[model samples]
Target chain A: MKKLKLTVAFDDGDYVVYAKLHYDRAPNLIAAIEKVVPFSNPVRHARICESEWMLSTPYLGVEDENFSYPDPGDISLHRAGPHFCGWYERISPIGTTDIFASVASEDLEEYRKKMGRAWEHPGAKMTVDIVEVDA
Target chain B: MNPIAQELFETGDRYLMERPEDIAAMRSRMGTRGQNMTVQIYAFSALGSSVDAMYLLQEAVAKDDYDFDTVVKFAVDWLSTLAPPADGSQGAAIIGHRASVHYRLDQLADLTSRASAALKQATTRAEVREILQALEHYYNQVRTWIDLEFPWHELAVKYAELMGDPAPRPAP
Candidate 1:
């Protein structure tokens, strides 16, 4: 089986990171995310979820899957506005979210820096796309 | 109406009031400088309360036909406040970046208008509940944006902090 990965590109592929999709745990969510591959949005920082940045995806709507507190590097979908959230550092427990993917450990440092900038200078453009990788 | 909701409606009435009268008061408060985010914040906060009142009313007024009309009246009254000042006096008093303020105001008005239209045709408690739910969603989004994105300075920052996320509650 091929592993699924999501490429999160910021500022039109200037800075990019790969997140391994948790298909085993959130298959439906992953599938829904795949359908919207190459999703583009303006990213903003989360006030409640510390060390997290979010992108409003008003277009994406899917049922909750594997919803729980997010750890650093975990990417999840929050159904309120149906936004996508990525936690780059240990965060306060705000509520549960559908965890579907995670940025690889090696990418955490850069991811943290990139997502952190949103706290001060937000509205950066972010693009997400699904890609196939070796299992 | 629930007692708490009734109290909230009265509070909202004080903040919003009728047009012309409240508009004149608001403009006078803005004065020549026209930079009063404080009053704007107060008005929006009161609107939040009114939205809550509508929700609470729905919870307890499911059996009362008259209660729905009361909720609709309160909603319509508050919705009137979102309209831009008639004499183009809105330029000075707008908080934050002008374009952002204008865009958000328009978006909020659009959402409210749609909800208002749907609410007019609604005949049952379940229908009203759905409308209130949409308004509640809009309120939370606006509140969050105000606290997180609005340019708060000095005392306003305290208010913004106070308005933070309503914290850790499950999203509806």
Candidate 2:
């Protein structure tokens, strides 16, 4: 039961943004996401079953099923292509997603709007850090 | 308030009342016949080009800009588009909806790949953001195609078992 951080840095590493993970609620997705910690990925705005902002965590091993629609500020991991995703708005994912974290920004809405397409930028890369919060 | 949003709300309210089983599907696990509401929503999401309409509707809800009639109309436009599965057979829309969801998923993956490639050619935050926003606009196009079609899975994992497209070891 811990919160992980998804930190994104782009513009030649001049910019950085952090999203907090909510693993306590979703015990199913943590292991898959953790194995590829400190991995770099670009964000994609996915719109299949539902359109939402998603970060990629390719080549991870996980098989947790907690199918649910995530709201804004929720971070989720789906094994379908091993996607490490976050929600910036109301759109849902195509299938079941085990939500493991969230962007722990004070103004989540602002963070979402500012980082809208930063991940899609070729230079944009995110490093997810698995941190345990104080109990 | 968009007129469509209003229509969507009335339809959803009426549908929910008449078919409690659809509500049950959302609350608990059920078969395709029980998932009429879920399929409709899924199709609606596929029909939408982007999350912008939901975003706008959310904004309206938060700001009290949306009235009762305007609330649900934006997402349930699919209700109007679905016919009785052509030959009036069961699971017709369910199969169709599954296909719609898969197609949209494929389309999104392709768009992301293409956008990333374009970003490679154009560096800088502004250029990258521009490309992403363009993709967003495309995602937003789902709304106009209310006339267009759109799964199951809560029916996918069952199939994912055959496709081996999902994860092997999930969170414990």
Candidate whose DockQ is highest: 1
Q: What is the lDDT of residue B172 in candidate 2?
A: 11
Please give the TM-score for the first chain of candidate 2.
0.72
lDDT of each: 0.55, 0.43
Fnat values, candidates in order: 0.00, 0.00
- For residues B131-151, could you state the per-residue lDDT of candidate 2 as single tens digits? 433433333332212211212
lDDT of 1 by residue, A16-93 (tens): 677887888788877776775665555677665677787644234355677688888999886654467889988677
Model 2 misses residue B107 by how many Å?
24
Clashes of 1: 0
Q: List residue ranges in candidate 2 displaced over 4 A.
A: A12-15, A47-51, A92-95, A118-123, A132-135, B1-172
In Å, residue A91's CA in model 1 sits off its true spot by 2.3
Relative to the true structure, candidate 1 reaches a TM of: 0.56
The digit string of per-residue lDDT tens for model 2 on A96-132 reads 5677666665757666654565323322445666766
Error (Å) of candidate 2 at residue B33 is 48
